[model samples]
Target: MKLKRLQKMSSFLHVVLKILSVSSVVIAIIVFFMKLFNSKNIIMNKLESDTIFYFQTEFFAIPDNQQYIQTEQWILVGVAIFTCILIAWLLWIASLIFKDLSTGFTPFSEIEINRLRKIAGLLLIYALAPQILYSVLHTILIPGYSFTFGLNMSFFFAIIFYCLTEIFRYGALLQKESDETL
Candidate 1:
């Protein structure tokens, strides 16, 4: 009964994740084109407005003589699009895992273990890539910008998923031995 419920839930979540993955890719594409065309009316103006908000929130004071650099704005938009793509990729992997769970009779299997490892690798990349990209671009585009390093929740999740994959592999091996004995 519990396995049935889990399978049903996994099926539902698989559908949801698939939809979210596609939607994120679509959003990333739209953002890319908006940035590519240099849409002054929409994306550029929005970035200008967001710069004020960022300064106000971070520094608690808005600079009166702050100049808007189009190159910096472009870099920020590129990072945003890259982040969206990464999110979509992660969601697609998650959807595949859920699809496998929904269809397979046993969760502790070789395919599922491999899928979990892939997710863990992707999560590690997702955690670090945007920060690295931003620092590199800013160091090149903006004067006197030092490299920044940070870690977020995704880093921790990557470790957890990798551990889980190992555990699942062990379980699969144990199950196989038991079945052979029987």
Candidate 2:
């Protein structure tokens, strides 16, 4: 593709990504507040209608003498909202990087390589965030929760980004050498 057309396409994509990121954040905030209010309503309704009780367990199966009572919701909405924001922020950063690279510079620029590195780091974080959040939520909300983990395809994208970062770094180094020799 022609450099000028490529530049235009990249700029267009950057704008689109920025718009998406902003919209995602706004939607996430809206969803969080809405869910919080909904959960509160649910909790209130439950509290008015029934008795809530939780027995203290000394082990997985044994209930101890201690007992507790409450009517509340764990409200996973916050976690979901935060995850949306996190992903949106990553998209924003990516858009910024693409915008910067969309100028009339070669792809092997040092700036491009650094941006790729940042993207790689973000991808790795994105891959890990859900697992970490799941473990935390499980421990907090579920009694006697066992350790659970599973690898998914998203991890492959993380690995792909890491490899791309290394490849970009190598390309930047070679470009620098070529420029110096010229």
Candidate 3:
């Protein structure tokens, strides 16, 4: 029957959607961990170079024999794993937020939704600013990378990412309505 065919189609679509969602989540986590590792490497390298300079020049009084390796490779690895998990959790939370917003999406709303919408808008602006700047400067600087700009780019990405979290929050409201109808 047409009903059974439609059910089969719906089930297939649902599975496909779940696969896409899980893949996106995994990729995002991988990206976060990669960024964490790279950042820690940069920090450790800078510190090592500075320690070497101090030993040679400022601390000529003392022998340049001490190894001042403050950061361990293991620490960076652990941090990367932790950060990736945190990002994944935030993604789940954002979905909840979006679900909530979806429930309140009637064009004519006189409640706190407007305030929340404004808040979301402001956050989007904040998140996009650095990305915009990074693109402009990267185009100009072509070869050289800006440390400050890099940090801003990462921060901006994080913000915009969690912003979608509201999707889950808003969507929950609609889910409730659908459940009640059943």
Candidate 4:
């Protein structure tokens, strides 16, 4: 029965991975086209809604002069997006790990949660190396500190982390049950 459950889980994971890959590609294509068509407009809008100059306008402070989002800042944003996507991808793979650990695709326990947390931390550090390096360099480019990417990516990670935690937490319980049975 356990073997059958694992097999089913493997099949499901295959399907989920395929869906994620297809969707990611489709989104990239759409984003590419949009960027090509409206690159200037997007830059113009960002400049128009430049929140940094809040006092310049009563409602919204548009940068009076054209200014580019700094290269380092751009890299930071790129890193944020990459990190968010990486977390999402890892969580997907985690589903498989949980299933493999279980007779079924069940949740893990507190101990397992801590283990996954460590893994998550490692993954975060790996993903953040580039951002950290660029931020350090950015300090050299800009004499003083500058605005960084907002916590928007954190919002997405929160949801993914919670869901994964819940799933793995259940696996933990089952794990305990199996140990007791043994």
Q: Which candidate wins on lDDT? A: 1
Cα RMSD of predicted structure 2: 8.5
TM-score of each: 0.79, 0.75, 0.28, 0.42
Residue 8, candidate 4: Cα error in Å is 5.9
Q: How well is each residue in 101-174 modelled by candidate 4, as lDDT tens digits?
A: 54443335565576566556545454344345445645555444433332234444545665676777777778
- Model 3's C-alpha root-mean-square deviation from the true structure amounts to 13.5
lDDT tens readout by residue for model 2, 128-153: 66546645664555454423344445
Candidate 3 per-residue lDDT over residues 1-182, each given as its tens digit: 86555555555554554455466568656655565667544432212221211221122222542332222233333334444444444444344334433443432232334434444544454434433443444334333332221233434554654564466446656766776899
Residue 166 lDDT, candidate 3, scale 0-100: 60
Alpha carbon lDDT of each predicted model: 0.75, 0.64, 0.42, 0.51
Ranking by lDDT: 1, 2, 4, 3
Poorest stretch of ten by lDDT in candidate 4: 51-60
Q: What is the total number of backbone clashes in candidate 3?
A: 26
Model 1's TM-score against the true structure: 0.79
The runs of at least 3 residues in candidate 3 whose Cα sits more than 4 Å from the true structure, single-residue gaps closed, are 1-71, 101-150, 157-182
Question: For model 1, how does the per-residue alpha-carbon lDDT over 1-182 read when each residue is reduced to its tens digit?
Answer: 98889899999999999999999999988877887786565443222221212221111122531343566677778888888888898899889889988986577778778878888898888777866786688667665453545666777888998998899999999988988999
